[model samples]
Target chain A: MDIAISLPIKDETLLPKLTIGDKIRVNGELFLFRDQVHKKIAENDTDQLDSINFLGSGVYYCAPTPVKEGFLIGSFGPTSSYRMDKYTEYVLKLGFKVMIGKGYRSDDIALLCKKYNAIYVITYGGCGALLNQYVKEVKLLAYQNLGTEAMQRVLVKDFPGYVAIDTFGNKLWK
Target chain B: MRQISCELFSNTLKSLLFETQYFIPEDVLENIKECYINESDSISRDVLNNILQNAKLSAATKLPLCQDTGIPQIFLELGSYVYLNFNLEKTVKNVVNIVYNEEKLRSSCVSDPLIRKNNLHCYSLHVDIVDNESLKVSVLIRGGGSENMSKTEMLLPGTTADEIKNFIVDNVINMLPYTCAPVIVGVGIGGTFEQSSLLAKKALLRNIGQRNQEKFYSMLEDMIKQNVNLKGCGALGLGGRVSVLDVFIETKPTHIATLPVSIVLQCHSVRKASKVI
Candidate 1:
């Protein structure tokens, strides 16, 4: 069944309902943290990340471009998820219940998701312009100097995606 | 000798970069439309539909088709009879820097490959002075997704056609989910190791459905296409019969001792544009 899930879900309220291959529309605040942010967090320079409670939050592996005139954000879409797989365990261990990007994650990442009872969703990989429609607002939360790699909070509305890994550890990508 | 203005070169290259980077070419768009119609699975159809919608949205909003404008490579065929007033290389670099660094596009160039600094946008420039008087410039916007996921192998010179086909189809299937299928697969066979890789990358410039002139290679290309699609990686890796939009095979004579093959994957947004002066 198709599901519409709001982001920053608390505990496992909406996560367990998600199963691998389920097409879902997710909206609400998603923290845009990609490679650099993960590196900073690993380096212990938590900066603005520590102030936020990531428990049950969804992190998007996306980097933003310059906002065009009359738009809230640029063509911000999902990057390949595997590059960030190294940080998946760390992010999940820190209490993230949802993560989103494109393509398959490491098998270990799927197991970690099950261990944390979290879900991983896959969105259109390179369709940045179309994905931009779901983004309503954005705010920089940390690392503003990092250009597109900075951490930000983006509020999306009815963004379409698929559950790549469900809470039970079932995964879509083989 | 025909004299071409440096400003004309700079201007033409600038506009081509700006326009082609945003606009999905008609062939690619049409193929995507076909994929969308043919996609049987609901999820894969949604992904293809989103790609179609993205093309329209990109055209209307002036937003980039993809955020990673990718590494911009220029292939120039300079006519021997043509002369330029200024340094063509410097002008090309300047135009590329401006186009990629502009607000709409992402500055993806990691200047020092070892240092990994994204400051310098590398101009992968190739020049071939042709005998004709008409100068041509072509740009290939190689996205990181497909480029990074590509594979190159140096196989035994005795490798048979089936062996080559198996290697290609297998790798393309594995790369499909990651490289953002439905993609354009460019295969470079023969040539030296480096030349084979270059041939493969250049093969991506071939228009979709354009086949090799030789019957053997063209048939090999068709076979590779059928085999990869039969594996069914499909669009967005959602599982269907059209993962690969097209396969381009380019071959060159190589030393009898060594055989090289390169598989270059171009994502659905095969951003290629050209102009003749």
Candidate 2:
């Protein structure tokens, strides 16, 4: 089943409507963070980090190439979800409601999602070019020195993906 | 001796980088289509369809096919009779920097492994002198997903054929979820530790589904392929009939004491290109 989802979803507002293997077209804000952003956040590098108020927001694990002449974003898509497994629990603990990436996540992520009533969305792994059109707007938020790993606030429209793990701990990948 | 211009090589490298990233090669595209036709699982088929659509879009748009344009490894076959006045590494670094900026590609390479600063030594380069009077360059763009999943093992000289096959099949299956399957497996067998790893990487140069000329190695490659596909890890490891697209194995004479084997994984986006001047 194909479902339409808006980001910054409230507590358990859309949990029952999502299930493993459900295709979703997402629209709304996706807070973008990749390798170093997660590292800095996990390290709690500053007091500023502690006050980030992205509660009930969608978080995407991706870092696209630089924007060329005229584009909202570069070739951007989900990175390998497993590599960010170590930082996932800590970030989720920061009150984010949705996680988006590609491939498998740790079993702990499934358990954590269940415990927190959160959802994990998996998109196409190596399809960044096709996925680039979803970015409606993008703004760099922090850590420009981190290069592509910098944090950004991204607005996406009709972003295509699937619910790989639901709030109930059901997983799409075996 | 024939003299070649430095700008010629630099221009070729720039175009190759763009060409490879934008267009999925004909052979690779054909192989994926074949796999899609044979795929029975609905989810796996959908993934394959997306891959095709992505390739079409990448070429049409001329943006990069994947966000990770990948670490470019340039291999040069310099003709022994050809004369070149430039230093290879410095030239590559200079040209790659300019080309990267022009294309607005990501700066992936770092200066020091520990310090983590961006540096000039971005591409891995290997040059060999050949008899022909032609300079040929081949570039392979390896993304993080498949490259990280690559493995190496030093088996005893006494290890049986079945053991080698099992070693490769098992590891690939286990790493499927992370590698972005279905992947093309490259195996380097029977060289010194370093040479074996090189051979494995070079094996990716083979056209997809092209078997080794020797019957024994060719059969071994087929065996590994069959075993992996039978496991049904499928596209993106989402459970399907095709986990591996193909397997290519390269071999060299090795020391009697040690048998080195290295497996390099190439994801669905098998980006490689070559040009001669």
Per-candidate clashes, comma-separated: 0, 0
DockQ each: 0.67, 0.71
- The superposed Cα distance between candidate 1 and the true structure at residue B11, in angstroms, equals 1.7
Candidate 1's displacement at residue B192, Å, is: 1.9
Error of 2 at B197 (Å): 1.1
B211: Cα error in model 1, Å? 0.6
Contacts from the true interface found in each model, as a fraction, amount to 0.54, 0.71
Cα lDDT of candidate 1 equals 0.83
Candidate 2 Cα deviation (angstroms), residue A36: 0.9
lDDT of 1 by residue, B1-277 (tens): 9999988898889988987767988888898898888889777788888888888988888888887777888889999999888998889989987886674687766657665555556668888889988889898988777778777899999999999999998998887777677899888998988889888988988887899999999999999999888877778787876888888889999999888999998888778898998
lDDT tens readout by residue for model 1, A1-174: 568898788646678877888888887989998887787776678856767888778899888667878999888888888888887777777777888888867788878887888888999888888898999889988887777787889999988889988888887753
For candidate 1, what is the DockQ-based docking class? medium
TM for every model, in the order presented, reads 0.97, 0.96
Interface C-alpha root-mean-square deviation, candidates in order: 1.4, 1.5
